[model samples]
Target: MDEMPALDKMIIYLDQLAISQIFKIKTGTYPSEAPHHAFWTEVTNLLQQGVLLQQVLCPASDIHRDESMVFTRGDELTLTHEMLGGDTSFRSSSEIEGDQVWAYLRGFVSGKEPILDLSVDSILDGHRNEWLSRLHISAAMDWTGIAKDVRDRREMSADNMVPLYERWRADPKTSFKSVLKTELESFGSSRVTAYLHFAEMARRGLGSIPNQFVE
Candidate 1:
């Protein structure tokens, strides 16, 4: 079983990306050199805005009301070059690209080996306490529900089970048509068609899943 749901993983990735961007904006530098205090300050400031806070956090359900801390009080935030993207020359600058962020996100949800050390204790968890409070809430939403359905209902075979569209969509370097065609040939028409249909639903809005099923 997938330990962390795909949609939840995606939300966490997006939240982390937003946090990194906000950190860069406030400090006039990327997160690599940012202090823990500065990072938390931006998070606190962001939470004060009602709409944007909702957009940024995207809490799914009542679990957001939970007051539990995701990271222990003694936990110290470390700033390291490795965590900040020193491994690959794909991005020479400190700024984390959208494509790189998405690739890491995809790798995370798919259980692929970590490329950038995204362990919960790392910078990704700076908002951990707040995010966990709202984590359960967002997981119950329609978008996440669709992801759950896809995970549960997708075929077991490697040919049909791999989320070709999702993986390709997350990677900027990959060609969608090429991947889809390859998947179609390997998985056959019936299975590939279902994947296409699900991808379409995911595109327009995952909230549309119920309507698509009804029709």
Candidate 2:
């Protein structure tokens, strides 16, 4: 059988867990007034941090009637599989050993934690702050010159790699999958190994793993 593409694999992994399921939010006017940006930003952060499996918004609805203060009701919130977009599809890694690769990707992109907690507001707030911090760090690191350092350390001569490297560098919006594939090919690393390394890095940054391979 032909091996599935890396991105397809990620999507399949997410689909298996039904993580694409849509959920709803029910709250009082105050909570409902929370901006969509705040809600989504929090959800994405949680997913990235492995806090939530999936993050989706609830369907829009009109107010039916105003109810008087009822302690029993106290703003009901329900999560269901009815809010996801009709055309939404997973795109990341294939399922491997029961791990939802797409779920991981969703978390990566959304910056949300994996474990879902009922304290939506608090979780969202934390994620927002974390997201801002990450942005700041990334912005600062943009001038690190690490890419040049790594290129210089590589054994392969730049003369031979000029063409390909130039093509990649010239592209303003290079896709991550394409970049991963290119780097793996250039470094003579197997796709699986490269992906494993990337996953580990996502879980634990550089130097977290002592060795790349284990006996």
Candidate 3:
């Protein structure tokens, strides 16, 4: 027997949980009303942990006010990378590039579900958030390297730098002072000491060490 690819497993799990229950719960219908079975709770938990991705089903619903639609039906949905404790990475259907996964999804929902017509090709699209997520991850890794360099230079005593390391994490606005303060506190170094040390290193034409030093 061929083993299922990891991506396929993820899609199957998401399809089962997202499609099956989201419709009923969001629609406020009794068919999906059991608190224990509510899918959003699980979704919320995943989102909090940055383990689940949320794609908006588009062509927004236009249901008759009188009808009780179980889920928000749409022709398209977006795929995004949910970051733990940070913003989400949004990707369009076009971004998803797995033919086997698409085929599996089509087969999985072809005649079984009313709202999902997997036959309709789903396009993977790109969003600003996707770029933002990448940028955030990049900056975070870079800052971690810088912090570790500082720690190694000063021989500071700290178990893990994550608390202060998070200062470089993505935010709407970037503030050098905020980042400096966080690094100072985390490394147990004063602002002058840290700045002078880094400045001297820069003056000496010493470029940032490779990230592998910390990782």
Candidate 4:
């Protein structure tokens, strides 16, 4: 059961890169006197205190945990997420989109405006608000081999996007709308196809219980 966090509470969103920096500091790869190390360490400590005091909400999402696939065994980011992410998470974009789309479809049938809850509270899932529930699984097994793939894809995209970007910028007539209609359609289709393929892989990886997660 999720508690609607105090409306007055500030939101702090830490993406994976920030988490990785903190992880490095934790492992002492960053020297103690390093400015980044000290900065991230202080930031993390303050965020932790803020959460404990309910002065802030550092919400996370499924992608954060999933992206941790890039980290191998003995290199768990789960604990860092537990400490800062605080169990409050946004439902995945797909799930939220599915619900909104379904509601929109229902509006056509009922001939009424779609009644959708767009508030942050509506999307949050506080899996365990109690103090004890934040304890993360310590041991990690089986690196998912995504780090290399991510690096390769990044490098590939960097190489590919430059010319497209230069071409677009050079053409005064080029517009986002035109790009969306012409180029983005294929990418969007591929995105959905890739999501389905990955979902299937996830199902197979989980074996018997697709919804259940074991850290």
Candidate 5:
């Protein structure tokens, strides 16, 4: 059998969770699907640091009654099928750290070690200020030079990547996915890594996504 694409791997990781399955059955909308921006907005809120998986399963924020189109009843066979192959460990109110949520992608993208600060900074160069405001970090650290430092790494030289980051900065309207696609291809990373990065970063209210790249 062919290996699953990285993006699908990430999607399946989410889909295989019992809570995510309930979200699908009750909401009748995939996390990637639209018409439920508010739903996902709340979901992303829960995905932030410190929030537990059980809390996300029943967020403190109320779901707008009108927006919830519960086409699949909770006890339905279809819903059961969805959860049959899911990871049900969280059904017991087990705490899920934000890091644990995207662990699958992190493992795939950079192996056991987390994505380095240098690589993360490179991806968020133009948008660092916006990202830093939301993500708490040491104020004393010099973040201004991180992008350049990562770009200067010897491993990236063969990919001719320096120009790409410049181009992304030059074009304010560039779709993040487009830039990410190029980077992943050049760096020999999977497309799933790009989408996983996008799900975490681009969706962080930094900027408008180009229509062509809409989920």
Candidate 6:
């Protein structure tokens, strides 16, 4: 965390693809004659100024860091991921989904509805303005290990999806409610596992768990 700004900043999450376009424009990797180049340049300039002025907070997550690894380190496309994010880091989607599932379960157990908030503020590391530091990588990573892990995960996913599709085909659901129970159970377990992976990352300082948040 860094010193807090006097005002709360609005959160702006840039999509990975748009970030890549901006990088291409800035690095001249995209043709100057391309009509779309000017649009990205303006966007890049606006966001840079907004972040620099503390008028907006752009928090990146482990998802961004991991996805950027598709490009080699120091690649123009790689640095694009960092330009506006600075030191701000957000919770992984896995953690948020887990929290959602936990909330829904608690609501069912207590016989009272749980109103879960899965908004940006719920996952932010600190005050909106506190992470306004120089450009920083949101997660500290072991690139080689991550690369291998990704390959293995994809291969395993391909194999597992076969049974998943087989189960769906056998079920023959005619309505959303027909499969709601199975969907909830399946996703709840998946979310828990994903959250645990994030929990491991948090231990290494790549992410944060709020003092009051529970898995």
| Residue 156 accuracy (lDDT) in model 2 | 54
Question: What TM-score would you give candidate 1 relative to the actual structure?
Answer: 0.19
The residue-level lDDT of candidate 2 at 215 comes to: 36
Candidate 5, 78-167: lDDT as tens digits = 333322222211211222323343565587686675543323222211221121122322112223334345434434564666688689
Model 3 per-residue lDDT tens digits across residues 45-125: 554333324232221111111011221342111112223212322233333433444555577688543343343224222
TM-score of each: 0.19, 0.17, 0.20, 0.58, 0.17, 0.63
Best by the lDDT measure: 6
At residue 26, give the lDDT of candidate 3: 40
Show where candidate 5 strays beyond 4 Å: 1-69, 77-79, 86-94, 98-173, 178-215
Residues 1-215, candidate 2: write the lDDT tens digits: 99633321011112211222112222223345556636644553444433222333222111100110111231221112112211222221232212544445567789996443333222121221121121211111131234444445443555766876777789958886898787778664554577888888787764565675533
Clashing pairs in 5: 6-192, 7-192
Error in Å for residue 23 of model 3? 2.5
Worst 10 residues of 6 by lDDT: 133-142
Q: Candidate 1 deviates by what RMSD?
A: 19.7
Off by over 4 Å in 2: 1-30, 37-79, 82-188, 191-215
- 1-215, model 4: which lDDT tens digit per residue? 99665345565668888877777776667687876777888877787788777667777675676667666632457676656656566778778877886787699799999999876667777633434344544455555665677667668879988877887889979888886686678776776688689889988878876454665
Best by TM-score: 6
lDDT of 6 at 189: 88
Q: Superposing all C-alpha atoms, what RMSD in Å does each candidate have to the true structure? A: 19.7, 20.9, 22.3, 8.5, 22.1, 9.4
After TM-score superposition, what is the CA distance of residue 50 in candidate 4 from its true location, in Å?
0.7
Question: Which is superior by TM-score, 4 or 6?
Answer: 6
Ranking by lDDT: 6, 4, 1, 5, 3, 2
In model 4, the Cα lDDT at residue 15 comes to 88
For each candidate in the order shown, give its overall lDDT on alpha carbons: 0.39, 0.35, 0.38, 0.70, 0.39, 0.71
CA displacement after TM-score superposition, residue 56 of candidate 1 (Å): 6.2
